[model samples]
Target chain A: MSPPAALRAAGLVKSYRRGRAVDGVDLTVALGERVALLGPNGAGKTTTLLMCLGAVTPDAGTVEILGHRLPRERSHALARVGFTAGYLPLPERMRVVEYLRLYARLAGLRRPDVAARAALDRFGVSHLARAMGTELSSGQKTLVGIAKAVLHRPALLVLDEPTASLDPDVALRVRTGLREISAELGTALLVTSHNMVEVERLCERVVFLSAGQVVANGTPAQIIDRYGHDDLEGVFLHLS
Target chain B: MPTIEVYHGAAASFWRVMAIARRHAYVLQRSPHRLFDIIVWPVVDVILFGTIGVFAAGRLGGAGQVALYLLVGVVLWHVVYQAQISLATGFLEETWSRTVLSLLVTPMREWEYVAGVALFGLVKLLGGVGAVALIAWAAYAFKITTLGWGLIPVAALLLAVGWAIALFVIGLVLRFGSGAEALAWGILFVVMPLSGTFYPVSALPAVLRPIGTLLPTTHAFAAGRAFAQGAATPWHELGLAAAGTAVMLALGFGYVVWMLRVFRARGFVTRYS
Candidate 1:
């Protein structure tokens, strides 16, 4: 039998008085598959991602993560799903290890401290485990945030602009680390980013969202060909 | 997302609750200033209030009567005030750190978060109450424990009021964001004057009398004062306080749960995240 989909969102819709933020969107990621969600500002990419994570309730539609339905069974779904966003901040007063341990425990790890230690090691951040969250640079925080998300070895991992603020060197390192980690764990990855280079490097398939609708979905090369462009960035600009 | 079977069983759920409490405790540990503030504030309040209580008691009644009265009022009021602030601040802390999104993504339920924060507040309540009780006995010869075993019910009722106020504050913070943070500290004071903490409910203006009578604090302090004076524990006032607590709990819990659902539906989860 085919593996269950990592994420499945159907006819999702969300609206504000100003306008619809996400409108009748459907998306899916298969088990162990890596996918990228691409869109311009106001294209509702983030809103869709939020719905998949069950953080935002859809106005209309269904989302199933790892087979559990959204909003209703979010708690069950979230147990094996992890999320990280570059913009989400960690507690300033907590040490890195302390923060990670808290999340590990919340994720229901049997030995949270051990899992936290291993995550820190996997991310090569064990050296900074004692540092306070506020003391870390944006790049370091991103690394720690990613480490926290993966501590429980979640089956489905969602990342929003994971390396948005990192320098080229750090971003490259993050990309390499994520690739290695995902491969080792066989975790399905759903990522949203404007960095076409990062998307091209990490995601085999891309879903282009425009005005809260999926305008394009295919391999990077296929999208490039469809847009009559030489690269993924050209296709992104064309669709967005 | 693939429906992965990764259930954190009932046993683990309990641990998750403790983990939330542990998270707050670690934050407190890292910030000695926060711990110091919680400990020092109540002690200072006792010293300041106790001195005034001494002078005020000379005018109203015997020293012993005044000390017990003042001590009970001060201690119980802190219990209510600190409990509300502690719970409200727990929510605010998550907002300030932009960690609410991180928290919501886990298997942790809203009730788990509430219970954990409430537990943390209970710890603070103990610290504040302990320090005040010690000072009351050491300095004023007034034993707070002497309010009889009935003090347990009184304290529980007062804490219920605190939890209600805390839930209201949580609703405000969730709805209005950090801008309404001042309500955490300001809310208790708004009701304090009408609460009949230092005076009888009848002393208030006629229009304010009904409002005072409705507040659980007013009834709590009345019963506490009566107990201090070696009078019959005011069972009627205690009953009124319990009824009032029920109302506040309903309103507070109802408002918070409703606002949270609206917030989640509106995708406000990422507002701070």
Candidate 2:
């Protein structure tokens, strides 16, 4: 089968009155590829991700998701994408099953219940499906958040700091699930996280952003080698 | 198949908002204290003001007249209070739970989101108003003889005005964070005393009449009282009030739309950092 671009952004520029938050950045991801966005605080990582999801508009740029332009025609584009952010949580008062089913329906799933349960089982959180969202621990909440994002089986997945608060074991389980999702569904995965080890292990490619600009772009190994670091963390510290 | 798909898409958006509202209502159900606070607070205000009217009957008006007047003011005030508090608190709650960012990423537009929240607020306000009106009617024989079909339009206008005020408050909250809550309450206090809510505008000092006329609630109360008293409403005043309400609503909605643009531009939607 011929490869298709799952996501593409060109000349993405977003600015506040004081200064630019994301400055003329460009990026692309192909189906079945797992890309990690690496950056320190104030690096415009989240801004880039929000722009891709059409949650924020760019002052100057073009974002095409699965061949659909963003912001101007985001409804069609978003229907084919799923997103999660570290700061955004599920409604705590809602039951896991209720929240997931609601999002599944919103994602246009025909069988929301089955799809929601399948996602929960995929993440090994099936037992918590009936529990209230507020009752879940931090790690459990993160897992549920990821499950909700993927339940729709979108062509693209964007996760912002997806595993920031998880313990090692839960984080590993999440990574494994993400890998399976990409391999099985050919979904393009673009994720941002501060965990360099996880990025190095899961991502085939890495993009390093610093102060609202792209500073590095290559494979994890290649980027690390060019920065003359043994690991992604060392490379991050060197650049940041 | 394409038509079915389109229908499904629209239904999904509707259901998403309904789900949010349902979950919120459920949480509110669990917090009986909050429910009681909203429902009972207005009732207490009516009783307190009613008693004060009774003691000052010689100075103000008769017990029945004072109760009739205060009941209209209290009910209308409750509507405004409920609408403003719900709008501000609902957005704040979403922000606190980080759910607003999640919703922003969805296919729903900003107008649709605001409409859904406003509808929810309207339902809650109407329920509170109904309960208070029922109680006052039973206890004090608060007769509303001319409260015919005409009252429906007045109520609808009042609801729209309340929602508009709430939207303005929501914009303030978004701009200044939780500190805006204090400002909102302070503004309400200032308006309540000056708007001829508890007493007639005629009783107001000559200097304050213009200030009272500027308030939309002043017109709402006057219209409501006229309906209750079986008197011909001053259509000119009502028309002017409706125009003022429309203007306020347009300005309030405009400010909210502007604020959302600012929030999106600044990446405040995901600015948890």
Candidate 3:
């Protein structure tokens, strides 16, 4: 028998009166696999991620994360899943350490401070622990956000444009640190990014989404080869 | 249909609720304005009305009882008003901070989260009411405790009414987004005039009297006035108020649950955009 996949989503459909956000989508990420989700704006990347995390209930679909069904067994499923997004900011009134500790506790860590500190140290943001969340620069906020996301060492870590708005140098550092952490912890990573460079650098496999559907799925090299393109960015343009 | 597997039993659920309460306490401890709103505003309202009652006693008939009457009404009304405000704003705060998505992605269930907010709001309400009662006694020589052990049940029923209103506001905000946040502070005041806080329910116009009787605060204040006049216990009024509160609570919880389902289905539960 095979080991259970970290994430399994099938026939996922979500629609607002505005229009269909996600339509008949199926996705899976193997344990310890790092996959990039690429799509243009309004392509349902955020909607799909929310459904997989059990943050949003799909109108018609099924999702299981770490072997637990969504919405029904969401509590169990959420315990092993971590998520970070540039769009979802932390509370400004809370200090960095306080914010991280809250999430650690919510994730059910026994000693939230210890887990929080480890995440801070790992992300090289330990010195900023006492600073208010509002005081941080854009890059600093992303670093703190990622540290909070990984504090409990979730089995599946999801990121939506994690490096969006950072300076190039800081973005590179975060990309490198996240890649190293995922490899060290053997955590399955599902990342969505518009930056093809980050995708090519961090992901082993790539899934391109367009118009609420998965348009292409393969390794970066395979995608570039299949699409007759020189790089991942060229492939994204061709597909999206 | 898939069945939900609850991770925590009763005990663990309590701890999760406490964690949320603790988070609010941390915020209150840090922000003076939040603390002031919870503690100072009610006391000021009591003093303001209490002073008016004192002055009116010298000038008009039946005015001597005004001080105690208004004091009791303001103090008790805070129990419900503050509770509703605190809990509704507690939920709204998450949306403003854009942290609702992060919270929903956790292992905590919806009921646990709501319970936590309500508990914290209750605690804040207790402190505010206690402060007002203390000040009323120390400064004016009026004793709210004179209402005796019956005050406990009265306060509980009022808090339940507050919880119901807060839940209803939360449901509205969840359905309509933060654009409806004004409902948190505004809804309570809409009911205040009809609640007969300063006047007896009989003083309301005949047409308004029927609507007034349906309000939990109406029965609470009536019982409070009877207690002030030395009624041993206003079981009749308390019983009716309790029944009214139960209905409001059921409606509030139903609205909250239904709105939450709408939020989830409409993809409003975790959108940061």
Best by DockQ: 1
Per-candidate fnat, comma-separated: 0.77, 0.47, 0.56
Question: Which residue pairs does candidate 1 place in steric collision?
Answer: A6-B1, A6-B2, A7-B1, A8-B1, A65-B1, A66-B1, A66-B2, A66-B3, A67-B2, A67-B3
Candidates 1 and 3 compared by DockQ, better number: 1
Q: Which stretches of candidate 1 lie over 4 Å from their true place?
A: A1-3, B1-7, B60-67
lDDT of candidate 3 at residue A137, scale 0 to 100: 91
Q: Please give, for residues B148-261, the per-residue lDDT of candidate 2 as tens digits.
A: 655665676677676777788778766666667675556667767777877777789999998888877778778877777778876865786688789889999999888877
Assess every candidate by TM-score.
Answer: 0.95, 0.90, 0.95
**lDDT over C-alpha atoms for residue B60 of model 2:** 63
Worst 10 residues of 1 chain B by lDDT: B1-10
Which whole-number lDDT from 0 to 100 does residue B32 have in model 2?
A: 72
Candidate 2 vs 3: which has more TM-score:
3
List DockQ, one per candidate, in order: 0.56, 0.46, 0.43
The per-model lDDT (C-alpha) reads: 0.86, 0.77, 0.85
Which of the predicted structures, 1 or 2, would earn the higher DockQ when compared with the native? 1
Tell me the tens digit of each residue's lDDT in model 3 across A7-93: 999999999888998998888999889999889999999999989988788989899887788888888888888889987766877
Q: Cα lDDT for residue B145, model 3?
A: 82
Point out the worst 10-residue segment of candidate 2 chain A by lDDT. A102-111
